[model samples]
Target: MNEKTVAGYCIRCNDQGYLTDLEQWNREIGLEIAEEENITMTDKHWEVIEYLQNQCKQGVAITIRKVGKSGVVDIKQFYQLFPNGPLKKASKIAGIPKPVSCI
Candidate 1:
């Protein structure tokens, strides 16, 4: 486990930088992570992030196809929102563990 300060809070994270403790996450931390990922948060982006976080809490396996089917955003738009690696980037910003489905 690695500890890093984000949004003035020291949080535990994995080697890949995904937060290890969901309880330690907040919107400010998410914003900082999004900035690090080079993404500017829009309401749409927050919607996706919320969706991802909720799914994670529910123990739902997150996948691009699932997110696409999720009313939040389609696959194309999800890609557009996060660019290079949507699932990985979004999950990171959402303060959830990196999905097993992600490479």
Candidate 2:
């Protein structure tokens, strides 16, 4: 399937057309998104992604949102704080891990 068909969003660039709609989560795309977000190896977002990558490699995978205390919020508040709503791009900047199953 195409990246758009899969992730529902394109990951090629930061623009609209080069962009594909985000469908859902996939490990390959997740890693790509991490790279696109410019997440450094020493950054907090990288820490979370590294943890998640380890877990996934171990067959003990977990979603990103559940790894921290930020999970304790309602939908409205969650989206308000995360306007883009946890895209890997924004998450890396915010120093939070990308949403495990997000597109």
lDDT value for candidate 2? 0.40
Find the 10 residues in a row with the least total lDDT in model 1: 94-103
Model 1 lDDT tens row, 52-76: 9999999998999999999989999
lDDT of 1: 0.94
Model 1 off-target regions past 4 Å?
A: 101-103
Query: What is candidate 1's TM-score against the reference?
Result: 0.95
| Model 2 steric clash pairs | 7-22, 7-23, 8-21, 8-22, 8-23, 9-20, 9-21, 9-22, 10-20
Total clashes for model 2? 9
Report the lDDT tens digits of candidate 2 across residue range 2-61.
233213534432232222323233445555544554433234444444544454445553
Question: What local lDDT does model 1 show for residue 20?
Answer: 91
